[model samples]
Target: MEGDGWRDIKVVRNPYFSLRIVPTVVPMRYLELAQLYQRLEKTTLKTLKTRLVADFLKKVPNDLLEIIPYLILGDVFPEWDERELGVGEKLLIRAVSMATGVDAKEIENSVKETGDLGESVALAIKKRKQRSFFSQPLTIKRVYDTLVKVAEISGEGSQDKKLKYLANLFMDAEPIEAKYLARTILGIMRTGVAEGILRDAIAEAFHVKVELVERAYMLTSDFGFVTKVAKLEGNEGLAKVTIQVGKPIKPMLAQQAASIKDALLEMGGEAEFEIKYDGARVQVHKDGDRIIVYSRRLENVTRSIPEVVERLKRAIKAEKAIVEGELVAVGEDGRPLPFQYVLRRFRRKYNIEEMIEKIPLELNLFDVLYVGGKALIDEPFIERRKTLEGIIEADGWIKVAENLITKSVEEAESFYRKALGMGHEGLMAKRLDSVYEPGNRGKKWLKIKPTMENLDLVIIGAEWGEGRRAHVFGSFILGAYDPHTGEFVEVGKVGSGFTDEDLIEFTKMLKRLITKEEGKRVWFEPKVVIEVTYQEIQKSPKYRSGFALRFPRYVALRDDKGPEDADTIERIAQLYELQERMKGKKIA
Candidate 1:
């Protein structure tokens, strides 16, 4: 794992086109790896990492540092510096050379000419190999860590150095290892395996209940922690772990209540209903002097909303606290702006000052999970509400979410209409006595959109799309989960609502996970879940699942969800039933 091992791997993997250079004095394993590449016609990052690790552990007597670079950066030479190359650029060159048997120099020249490394790689690979060798397995945690490290690095470095590192890592990987590495780099894995697959794997591996894994994931958003514990303690340690606050619990989804009154009815006739705002979900943590803001995906977004961070520091009256709220952007007139407008502000890297001035945001506070060094997840909703209200002083920029204690469905309905009139989404009903459940979406809370219904679809198959989508499989065929067999049955295909930028980004991402081809189509491992919005749901014999969504559009990718948590067929049936109920009630 030393630096030199990485350098050596980078050299071998960095060839422009196919080269028949024999190693002067390399280990047998290294030679074996190269021969395997020659036989397989291609190698991936995941496979390389696994082989390198296994080889290292097996005392294979190879230069692991040289191998680490090959596995991590795709560089196999001793002279390359990873600091000089961009991860994407390195991957592009390596992919091209591997697929085409073309000289790495030719690919690099093409990349330099077009300044489109991704495109060059794609073309090279396409011309070199008609079919992919294997699919890589990628997890979100690994990618997140890698990106964080990438972001941490500083200074000007040549793209070639970076490529060398990435190329070397991938060239030395094994199939399964490559699968994980590729998935991580691409940022999505559609293995058709539910989150339950990993959960079950972890549970069995550690000997802990599935519930504990769920709880831990909810609390920390760290799957690696569970895996590590399972590796070390052997299940008993995992079972003994308790869920605590300040550890970051998952945000609960607001339950849909057609009217404020209906929400109260769901809460047993008298309940607390909060006005669901049209804004971004934000989780704020204050560790004494340090304040951090995270999105629902647990991404560190403190830099994106420095204003909110400043506001929280002033308004939150606690020594140490972790709270959740909705971040709403407002116009100069002081009214809340559209959610899309708020999102645009976050997406921008340039002219941030101008954007912030043009689209100021306010934080509408909701749940409080920690205060004064104590966790509040175990507290009842009512108690937590009181604690939150007591700790935060509402200001022009930060305010408590509007709520009402109601007894009848009619009253709840009235509030719902008022919120809609204010251009809000809808209402969120919570069980007054419920505890904060991390990583679980249940009846304790539900989300009711203002207009069209939302479907929590499980992604089944994705095709490598055209134009900008040539790299990642852009259009996804989604399905409803079958509870009995624990499978995803296709319901519809969504190809709209994605920005061109997103299309390009996703294409590069999806390409790495492709496992097989069917005629002109490529298949992937389905593990990602996305929330889709549609104009209507229709019964269909054409789709594999016997259903379809009209005007289906991308809403957001769900990182917090597990495949088991995807919308089930029974839930689809419930939506249909609810539609019918609404029809009958309306006619009456």
Candidate 2:
């Protein structure tokens, strides 16, 4: 290839995502991944997406296996690794301007039309002024190494160095390559190659069982290493993967059940109803005297919440163990504080002890994944609870969640009421025989929140206000994801709950993310997430999402969540069915 394009890879197109047939002499190139990304983006069939990744993996050389998966996932490092490029958006814009020789204002104009920074950069690279007639081929390894350097840069003039490095990189990248580079650097590949797809892909590429690959991925939380192990060591090696003490595994997720009776019925008449605390979900790892804590997203937040670490260090009976629990920030009155307060404590880099004194955390242990040098994930829920009961002697600061084991709906309702009376969110009804499956939402565990639980929705489009509100957005269109297609569909519009302060703050926050404007209504790239409370979920033709939220009201701006983290169309339908049931309607 001529110009500043990547080289040395042969391509084979497959109906499903697949490995390209590369000659032994030609090492894998970044172009191959870029092409795969393009193909993955074109098709909405998730099965094709899985095959595309599998095919890509089949052609990956053993040495590049570990690095390529991370690139494909758009993560420079493993999921548990905390390193980031540290380059800000303004700096990125400068880098783009320098690489393309396009005016910064012109690039911003392109963003308005293209609706995506990556796409605008790709368009800009078409007009790159410093293009070379013949340049060294860009390789995945070079890009990965360069990005690692960017992440490693720190303190005093680091921004300048990062900007220079990024500019040079974008200058070297071809139009298509630059598009993906922009997205990769921003950690928004948008390739629809979620970890689940890659897990299945690895299983198919290596002929190992999908369950084996999933277990390995779940335990390690790194597909690059899992792919490497699957490719080099096969199933035997994958089976060897186990949860380690310093590494944080993805926490098991619960399904949302509309009612307590429904959850108990799913759990074979008897279940464990534990109070669901309104707080952050945390995973604690104890190895000897040191303890590390991780959030629900596998973020390493040990330093942010020191009290949890010290408390766990002294509370655990075993030297090596991993447990999952909720860390609720309680107020001086002993009532649980809002999630925002605990979030601040979890995010503080300095004055952590000061924040701890102001917002004390109470740990309510629920499940144990590992203990006494043994992994208990394969054990039944009851056995794991029994093991957890034996592993920790609760001081007041740390205690197992209060729970009730009963088969009667009346008893379950009473337990739930007691929990709600205590100002908790609700109760978690768990199947006694269910085994813990990491990063999965299944009937094994069901969440029962009273009445209608709030929905986390993404803002798809917004309308500017009139008169006094003309300076800010007045109404916002909400959207939910369709996991199968990876598309966002409109569910409702919210305008009622914002204060004047909220309107000003939200308008400022969303202006930069605007994609296109049609009169007073402006479209967005689905970046901002807001929690919405609604009276009911009703079937409607007003939105393509097939369901809509009735009388929706804005709750809070969920800065912690992204579009993917928002609710799904499937959830909307589930809630709709639940509402119908509550109205005493019978299904055919």
Candidate 3:
């Protein structure tokens, strides 16, 4: 019993180091973070949680503060980094089973009861059949290093290596630490500490303004870097953060308008309207001759679209710039296909050239954020548009999106009809004086489609299929993101709109995400984003979001989006209210 307590508090020297790093240390126990997790779980007040994290950060040693931010986020690297633990649930269960000397069957049973692998690990440790007298207390440095090592492991028997590393952490952890350690490795940190909260915490901890911290985060898209910057250089360093060529920024989002006339009115009786193509949003960054393309979600997609790279390499006239556009999938007749066709090309890791030949793309440049070593986010939209138009040497494969500047509703409506006739979605309206804002959704920009009411929802739970549809998930329980709580709450479920081919691909993709199953009902980890259409919105007691979609139909799988980018519960409320006002009017 004394050894057990000793193993929870005593210092253990970390055996991991890189040849490049100078061996910076935190001088804290991993138990500190686990304790913070416990405290965060005990409260639902966001202010309290933010204050707790701010206090914890204020006490940290500055030598290696970067790792702590990512750790608290349950990630080994920054959000833009491609590295992940890549460890699935079964591998985690095996690691827990191996560490506690608990049988695999019993651990599985525990998972069934708890519905959380982390909790299962905590419970299994109590009945341990193995013990080590020489085991030392785990340090924050060791735990962080070990999981990062797990992420870096690849090629040939990597699962065995990942299992061994995780098991070692478990052997050294106390029960509470074991619970969080598992969850962190699985990338399911349930602390409700969203990036927004952490951003606020960094500001509070360092006595810097929240806006400065937010600007730095928006420019770099890396909270780890922001934390270290705030610690080392304070407010001055944070204010100086600028856009880099390779790192991706979170793209700006838009709101929806009822009609072209309404869009014109919202923009003060005049607006810049451009065709909104039915394609994935693509961000292009260039430095010298090198160029990188990113998807809407800031995913590095250079390898996925080789021809786009070639086209961009020769199309842009500037030596350094960051531009954005729509990369539409085009058919043999040169008509644009749906956005999923572009997503299919982006997701392919093998036979990419063949897929490119099968589905071609057209890049229509729209906005420019950076050029000549200066960020243009502060520039007015009209100026940015002029800059974008001047730099791009347009060709058939790559060109600027068609636009019309007008204050007349008749012209805007004609332009909208022309866009639809040209096989595009509709038109996007932007205020001439609006500045480009990253990761923001407001009235600065608006989307006006013929019927633009689709919602991007994440699948939270589902039911198994029946009869001929028995091979795949028959119905999916969908939820909208709640930014306030950092949770996805149920809004509706859809059992229709899936093609036979969709079922086959969905079965292959979703079987790996099964957390726990009960008869025909299965719960998922909220990874899959899908576009959905509904007849109307209704106040309902059946869903946690307090609203449900009427006759919801699945549109497409948004493989390009993550769960965080899904429509928010607030947005659903707005849409519901909008529908109520249009009760008598016929909606397209």
**Candidate number achieving the greatest TM-score relative to the actual structure:** 3
- Number of clashes recorded per candidate: 79, 7, 0
Poorest lDDT segment (10 consecutive residues) of candidate 3: 1-10
Give the alpha carbon lDDT tens digit for every residue of 82-122 in model 1.
12223554555565465446788987787555443444554
Better of 1 and 2 by TM-score: 2
Q: Write the per-residue lDDT of candidate 3 for residues 181-250, one digit (tens) a residue.
A: 8888777766767777789899999998899999888888888788989977999999899888888888
lDDT of 3 at 247: 86
List CA RMSD, all candidates: 10.5, 6.5, 6.3
| Clash tally for model 3 | 0
Show the colliding residue pairs in model 2. Answer: 17-51, 17-52, 18-52, 18-55, 18-56, 19-55, 19-56
RMSD of candidate 2 to the truth, in angstroms, is 6.5
Q: Which stretches of candidate 2 lie over 4 Å from their true place?
A: 1-27, 41-51, 97-115, 119-135, 207-212, 234-241, 256-265, 407-414, 464-473, 500-528, 559-565, 585-588
Query: What does candidate 2's lDDT look like per residue over 11-104, in tens digits?
Result: 6788897767853355456788888888987886889988998998887766677888888777688755768787755778899898778988
> Quick one: best lDDT, which candidate?
3
